[model samples]
Target: MSEGLKRDYQLCEEIGRGRFGTVFRCFSPESGEFFACKSIDKRLLLDSIDRECLDKEAKIMQLVSGNPNVIQIIDVYEDDSYLHMVMDLCDSSDLYDRVSKRIFSETEAAAVMSPLMEAIEHCHRHGVAHRDIKPDNILFDGRNRLKLSDFGSADCFSDGRSMRGIVGTPYYVAPEVISGRDYNEKVDVWSAGVILYIMLAGIPPFYGESAADIFEAVLRANLRFPTRIFHSVSPAAKDLLRRMLCKDVSRRFSVEQVLRHPWITSGAEGRRDQ
Candidate 1:
């Protein structure tokens, strides 16, 4: 890698794009590791606050990127035109594509979520809140190792206080977030629950035709596990989802609780039994 925006990596193809940036498939000849280069146009960062958050995002990655399940910023470059970050390229695609297209078995979902919960716990311990924890952000590598990527909407809480402001995809927004109340990292639990629901049922627990409607549904939080969908799902899995998707923050499960949950542990025990 070079000192500035110029580097030895060759950006091969456009892999992903979002409002904040575009991701390109990149290759490094020296390391022989495929990476995804996320480039954010400077014009999109209209103010200093936006730029600060972008820099903070990079800092958060620097703090928690050591985890195997975390797709961290490998290297960064900035100039007048854009800010670019070379990140781990998870070749197996995202959870949205996996479970959204085809429902993974309840046991399979539990196994996948095991590493994810640990990764979230690791981030929380580092005081970084990955506010956005959706299926799209959950990725896997060529070997099917899970990773949680995309830190654009992530936040850091050093002083230990609830963050105020509605930020995150409406589909996965927590009820407190929709109600415009101060909320903590538990918002991520709701998002992870929603992803789990989608993984088990092949659909979002809350549904609507528009963004407003989706927000309303989230605020209501009427999570119904239809028999047609959840008939084959284990009772323990449903219980975990209910605890996670609970509207009351006090009642909702934390990342630690999720790791200790029976459903998750059962999968581990079963694997050992085998």
Candidate 2:
């Protein structure tokens, strides 16, 4: 740890690792509280683009800090060799881990997804788009409240303009992203829909043996709710999924629209609004 960081917090054991940094549990003497510190080695940032991504992650986290469903970055420190970010410590398992351990009923899945949609809506309202919205990015704090983390692949967008690049995990990636076309915030809705599918079905809506095959499936955008697996799933839930996983971006449900859907509004109780 750098001298400035050492003076501020006592770094403890390693808890996680990401593409460019290692996350450690740290203690802040000033507040007598624990936080997760992501220490990114300066050497790994080889170009301006790399440095910009790091800066963007910090700014995006700050941009959406007010949302309770989103992780808040408390402080940031830089030194000769590393960039350190201190943020909320979510020691519990991520959404992926929890879902993998058990199957979720429609109601249970809705309970988990409501706050996540709120988090995504919060990000969208702030003109930010989380390019990556995978299960691993969804975390739970000590209180078990859902908190969305990992802004490394997030970016800001404006109306009438679009973002370029295919940036997302294969299973949850939006079809528009795979098509190499300029996409907007709706891509996130597609990913969130995938999460909903996985939560209820215990499997991804799209599948393949390899990344390429998965990409092909995503490009095909043939969404189906297997009767065997989805027989017990609600029609309202399936309807929402069809709207969310729609290949036509114009027809896909927006985050706000999703929040207001009957399935969502009814608390996903396997019933639709009258």
Candidate 3:
């Protein structure tokens, strides 16, 4: 325990766990503030190749944390066995938990999505791709501001250079990625579309009991909006979903285009007027 950390902060219980690290709820006695410290195992990243990936994730988070939709990484500490990142802690739970309780209206979903799309747009603008955009990584702060976390699968890429290697959760992977074709950050938009689908429907757009079945369904690229479940959804909402979920990446609406989308703009205007 003596070598577990530096002296500034005291570690609390574990808040979450991921393949790379365990996140802890920590408190700084001097600042009297709570922060999340993700302790990434240095042993797992001993390989030069794996080390580069984790290093890149930290840089990307540092580069884009200033954005409103993304969580802040306040500081970093490293020891022989671990690399610890001190980050903003969101206590309101994840977006998945919120939606699990009830289906969100188009307006409600739009409000939550507006800032997220901004964050994604900001990341793309900065040449970063957050391959994982599942609901579990999206959290809400005390003020209800949605913050995007978990950039472990994130990458930084050159413009127009195809980012090879399919990375992302199976159910949310873009079709182009599944086809083993060269892909870019547009893949994140597709994942966001999947999130929107789950937010409104309380279920995934594509699903199967087995991993193979899920992959086949994703590869099939058929989106089902059963009237029974979607009858109450609006045309504008469905239109955005259609374009965002378009199988063809070329035909998919870019993040900027999505921001201008009526579904998003209308909700923004509503929120402003209220």
Candidate 4:
């Protein structure tokens, strides 16, 4: 490690690891502040696209630094063998782990979704599309306020540019993404809708034995409400979900429209069974 990149921080156990890096819990000795240090191995940079993605992610984090609902990227530096990013340490489990334990009530769902919607809107306004908006990317603070994370697959929109790459997780990908059709910010909205569906229903709307099957299911399946399972779910909730999951990107509701939906704005009271 380079001396300039070295800092006096107590390195604790690993918090998480992904394809490109490992994250550790660390505490600053001088400030007595805890942080998550994500270190990406330099060896992974052999692939030019991977290196570009890393650079893009770092830049995107820098661009969105001031937003409270987005993860704060405190510092970035390169060591002799790795790139390290120091970030705000969020102690709460991701939305995925929480939903796997129990389904969220309408009020609980709203509380989580409200900040998430704001974060997405903020990113959209800045021309960044968080192509991957799954439950694992949504982290909670001690108060259960959500902060969006994982921008490795994010892309900035430019007119006349074709979004040709295969990105995003199969379960949360929009219909157009699965079909290999050009898409835009609407893809993120589709993923967000899937996240909301999982929050309330405790499972993804489309499921299959394999990735290809999942893609096929997503492209062909009708957006069906599990009325029998969620007997207490309000009609407005169902209506909003339907509009969001539309296969036609042109028909899908925008994030702003979703925020103004009767089910969301009226609060959970309107979503409770009468």
Could you tell me how far off, in angstroms, the CA of residue 143 lies in candidate 1 after the best superposition?
A: 1.6
Give the per-residue lDDT of model 2 (tens digit) for 158-239. Answer: 6667899989899999988988998999999999999999998899999999999999999999999888888888788999
Global CA lDDT of candidate 4, please? Answer: 0.84
Residue 97 Cα positional deviation in candidate 2, in Å, after optimal superposition: 0.7
Best by lDDT: 2
TM-score of each: 0.91, 0.96, 0.91, 0.94
Residue pairs with clashing backbones, model 1: none
Lowest lDDT sum, 10 consecutive residues, model 2, at 265-274
In every candidate, how many clashes are there? 0, 0, 0, 0
Cand. 4 TM to true fold: 0.94
lDDT of 3 at 178: 76
Error of 4 at 39 (Å): 0.6
CA shift of 27, model 4, Å: 1.8
Q: In candidate 2, which residue pairs get closer than 3 Å at backbone N, Cα or C atoms, i.e. clash? A: none
Candidate 4 C-alpha lDDT tens digits along 63-123 = 8777889998987888668888888888899988898999888878878777888899888
In order, candidate lDDTs are 0.84, 0.91, 0.84, 0.84
Q: Give the lDDT of residue 4 in candidate 3.
A: 40
